[model samples]
Target: MAVTQFNTEAMEQCRTTVSSQAGQFGAIGDGFSNQYGNPEIFGKLGASGAVSSAVSAMDQAGAQEFEAAEKVLRKVESALDAIQTSVHDVEEANKNSMRAV
Candidate 1:
């Protein structure tokens, strides 16, 4: 005869850890947005009064550079959300199986 044991405590811990990680990811994303969400900073380069035209084009183009970083952060946050949800689902499934047994 084989004995099967379920460690639900560990599963719950994992779920908690995953939820925290997801929250951290979301916080990072929000922080990135808050820090660089404004285009005005990237819009102006050199003296404010003169507004150097020499690098004006480059300055304008640079504003969009941070957009990719924001997108990547959002993607990571979304992935973490999925992982967290999957962890919860697995925990529930295991608990159900234990109950059935």
Candidate 2:
């Protein structure tokens, strides 16, 4: 319990320190500030950013696939409606013929 309280106090102090600094969080500066301080590390960070962008693009593609599949399902439903109507008409015609006989 004492350790938890100590850690919580330390975290609040750190938060206060960060909040006092304006513009400390800038473009690509939030998580990679330390990396940007070193040129070699910054290059690796650029590559990591590219990978992150690619993953986001793939996620968009997955959403598009789901939309396309939904369109196909709607078409299938329309076709099934037509088929059902034809079947019902045929059944009605057969019933009328039996009544005539």
Candidate 3:
């Protein structure tokens, strides 16, 4: 069987990048709402409600996507750790058996 090696550092970096992107999107949404989404401005356009709704939807979607990706990565990391432990245990058992012979 081919040895399975998990690049934990790379996975962690990917998770951090996704989290940072999510945070950046949230900050952008906040800034957009505060700057260009002024009630007075949107009211003058006669689409204040529609604009606010769109912004909220985008923010929610981004958050959900990031959250899902992070969860998957966490699960993968957990599985990798379990596999490593199991492999080590098997190796130790084999060594003990050989020493007894």
Candidate 4:
């Protein structure tokens, strides 16, 4: 059997990094939407169907990217919770064993 040590601090750092990235993704999405997806921009583009479509697609892509980042952040949070639970369980088991000894 291979033994693996859990580094809670490292996990926390990873979670923080992922969360910051997610925030960045959301900011980018918002900026893209504001710059290109606004009604005024569509009016200015004025019946240039191809350009409007492209801008809309880019906006959608940005939104999707932000959503993906948020999902990754959620996964990281869940992993951290699971690691903490596992450590607690192990400590409880160890205490029980010592009590019986």
Stretches of candidate 1 off by over 4 Å are 1-53
Query: Considering only N, C-alpha and C atoms within 3 Å, which residue pairs clash in candidate 4?
Result: none
Candidate 3 local Cα displacement, residue 9, angstroms: 11
Clashes per prediction? Answer: 0, 0, 0, 0
Each model's TM-score, in the order given? 0.45, 0.48, 0.60, 0.66
Off by over 4 Å in 4: 1-3, 34-47
Per-model C-alpha lDDT, please? 0.54, 0.49, 0.61, 0.73
Against the true structure, candidate 1 reaches a TM-score of: 0.45
**Mind giving the per-residue lDDT tens digits that candidate 3 earns over 13-35?**
66566556655655554443323
**TM-score preference between candidates 1 and 2, better one:** 2
Q: Write the per-residue lDDT of candidate 2 for residues 29-94, one digit (tens) a residue.
A: 233322222234336675766665565566556555555555554455456555556666877897
In model 3, the worst 10-residue window by lDDT is 29-38
lDDT of 3: 0.61
What 10-residue stretch in candidate 4 is worst by lDDT?
Answer: 33-42
Which candidate leads in TM-score? 4
Q: TM-score winner between 1 and 4, please give it.
A: 4
The candidate with the higher lDDT, 2 or 4, is 4
Query: In model 3, how large is the Cα lDDT of residue 82?
Result: 66
Count of clashing pairs, candidate 4 = 0
**Model 2 stretches astray by more than 4 angstroms:** 1-44
The number of residue pairs in model 2 that clash at the backbone is 0
